[model samples]
Every structure is written in C-alpha cells, then in structure tokens.
Target: MGKITTHVLDTMAGKPAAGVRVRLFRGAELLNETVTNSDGRCDSPLIENPSAGCYEIVFSIGEFYHIHGTESPFLGEVPIRFSVEVGQHYHVPLLCTPWSYSTYRGS
Candidate 1:
C-alpha cells in the first residue's frame, strides 16, 4: 500500500514551519487534518493507504503567520494537488514564506 506524508519549512525563517495546519483531500472529500510538530512534520502519514488518484494537501500558511504575528501575510492557504500510484510513497513537502511557496516530490 502507498502512503502520503508532508512537512513544512519556513524559508524566510530558516527553520521548520511548526504549528502549521494541514488538510488532506482525495478529490472533493477530506481525508485527514493535522498540524505540524516542532520539527515541522506531521506525527504520522496523512494517508497510510492512499490509492491511485488525485489528491490535495492544503497548508494554512496565513493562519500560521497570523499566529506568529505577521499582521497580514501575502500568501493565504497553499494547496498542492498531485497524482499518486498504488504501492508508491508520496512525500509532498512545502518550502514556504509569508510571500511565496514551493513544493515537489521527495523521498
């Protein structure tokens, strides 16, 4: 079975983006919701047995900045949509700042 996992990095701060809210969705249906820990990673995989299909992971970066006192962050939610295959692992990590963000497939 395949699995989905994620983490956040605060590029501006040069550290992990802890306390960020993350949401997982398979198509239009929400699958899981979690928050990043001190290491900027979730406690466990978002989906332990994700089937082959389209999926999305929404990162609440605006809220994270707001809590960290960024007044009005330029970037709001960051949503990453991707495709996965059965029996393959997907590591979708976010490298972000209050103004911009990026993501890619990782091991």
Candidate 2:
C-alpha cells in the first residue's frame, strides 16, 4: 500500500511551523486532521491507504501565524490539491509564510 505524509516550514521564522492545523480530504470527504509537532511533522502518516486519485490538504496558515504572534497575516487557509498513484509514497511538504506558501512532492 502507498502512504502520504507532510511537514511544514515557517520560512519567515526560519524554523518549522509547529502547532499548525492540517487537514486531509479526498474529494469532498474529510479523511484526517492533525497538528504539526515541534519539528513541524505530523505524528502519523496522513494517508496510509493511498491510491490513485485527487486529494487536498488544507493548512491553517492564518491561525498558525497568529498563534506565533503575527497579526493580519495575508494568507488564510492554504489548500494544496494533488494526485496520488498506487504504490507511491507521497511526502507533501509545505514551505509557508504569512503571505505565501508552496508545496512539492517529496521522497
């Protein structure tokens, strides 16, 4: 079976984005929700039974920056839409700031 994982980095802060809320969704169906640990990594894999389909991950960008003492962050929830294939391990890492964010497939 394939798997999916994620991590967040606070580019502005030059560190991992801890305590950020992350949610995974397959189509309109909610799959899982998790918070980033101190290292900005989810405690567990987001998708343990990954398959070929479109998926979305929502990152609470505004809230994360707000909690870190940044007021009026330009970005809110940042959603990354992607597709997974069978037997693939997808590591979708988010590099984010209050105003911008980016994601890419990892090993």
Candidate 3:
C-alpha cells in the first residue's frame, strides 16, 4: 500500500509543532486536512495513493503562535511540495523556525 506520513519539529523552539493546522492537496484540489497532535504528528497517515503525484501541505504557523500568545514573526504560512512514487513509503518532515523552515525527502 502506498501511503504518506509526516512529522514536524520546531528547531528554534526545540520541540514539536503542536496544534499546527495541516492542509494537504493534490495540485489545486484538496485531498485531506489534519491538525498536529501533541507529539507533532497527524492522527492518520498523510496520504494513501498508488503512484507518484504532485502534493502540497500547508502549515499554519502564524495562527498557531498567535492563538497561543507568542510573539512570532513566522509570516503565518508555509507550504511543502513533493511527489511520491508507487510502491514506496514517503515520510515528509518539516523542520521549522519562527522566521524560516526547511524540509527534505524522508524515509
């Protein structure tokens, strides 16, 4: 089975990105949506597909911090774009800071 999963860490804060809103989309159309758990993980796998396709996940960083009452300059939004291959498991992880973030293909 082809599936997708993700984990998010706030490098600057040195913890998981809890309560971050995650929006998944296949091109312009959304496929699923989820929020980060306490451990900074989604309750379900990010995606389950058979073959490679364009995908995007948007993270609501600004709102998360604002609601929690933190002085943040994260710009409030981040998006990660990637593709998955058939018969393979893809792990997409986000390492973020208040002002910047980074990501790469994961296992």
- Compose the digit string of candidate 2's lDDT tens values, residues 1-107: 68989999999989999999999999999999999999999999998978789999999999999988888999999999998889889999999999999889998
For candidate 1, write residues 1-107 as lDDT tens digits: 78999999999999999999999998889999999999999999999978889999999999999999999999999999999999999999999999999999999
The candidate that achieves the highest lDDT relative to the unseen native structure: 1
Better of 1 and 3 by lDDT: 1
Backbone clashes, each candidate: 0, 0, 1
The candidate 1 region of ten consecutive residues with least summed lDDT is: 45-54
Give candidate 3's error at residue 100 in angstroms. Answer: 0.7
The lDDT, on a scale of 0 to 1, for candidate 2 is 0.93
- The whole-model lDDT of each prediction reads 0.96, 0.93, 0.83
**Candidate 1 overall Cα lDDT vs. reference?**
0.96
For model 3, the local distance difference test gives 0.83
RMSD of each: 0.6, 0.8, 1.5
Kindly provide the TM-score of model 3 when superposed on the true structure, using C-alpha atoms.
0.89
Q: Distance (Å) between predicted and true CA of 13, model 3?
A: 1.7
TM-score of each: 0.98, 0.97, 0.89
Writing each residue's lDDT as its tens digit, candidate 3 over 1-107 gives: 88888888988779998988898888898888899999999999877763678788888887877776768665588888887778788888888877788888787
